[model samples]
Target: MFFSQLINLKEDDSSMQFIIITHDAEIFDDSSVENIYKFESAPDGTIVSRL
Candidate 1:
């Protein structure tokens, strides 16, 4: 299962851009996502979080 969110950013010149946040590891590691950032979380309990 995966979760995702989209965010909008506005610039001083009134230009708008979009940002995407997701839990997909493959998408994060893909070369096409060179300009994107990735974050990882630690296990909170007995379950280990992947990607």
Candidate 2:
């Protein structure tokens, strides 16, 4: 519900920027998202990648 509202808000106001950290992949399913970063724990250390 919150995500849906956020998406609508973004559409209404183009200037709004949101940085969201979520475990649910459904958030990334939105077509509005152009860039996605994934953080994962590796044996050596934490790794960040663009998806």
Which has the greatest lDDT?
A: 2
lDDT of 2 at 41: 95
lDDT for each of the candidates? 0.46, 0.75
Candidates in order, TM-scores: namely 0.27, 0.55
Give the runs in model 1 whose Cα sits over 4 Å from its true position. Answer: 1-16, 28-34, 41-51
What's the TM for model 2? Answer: 0.55
Q: Count the backbone clashes (under 3 Å) in each candidate.
A: 0, 0
lDDT of 1 at 44: 60
Give lDDT tens digits, candidate 1, residues 1-51: 122222133224563344666666566563344355545555763434333
Best by TM-score: 2
RMSD of 1: 8.3
Which residue segments of model 2 deviate by more than 4 Å?
1-14
Q: Where's the lowest-lDDT run of ten residues in candidate 2?
A: 9-18
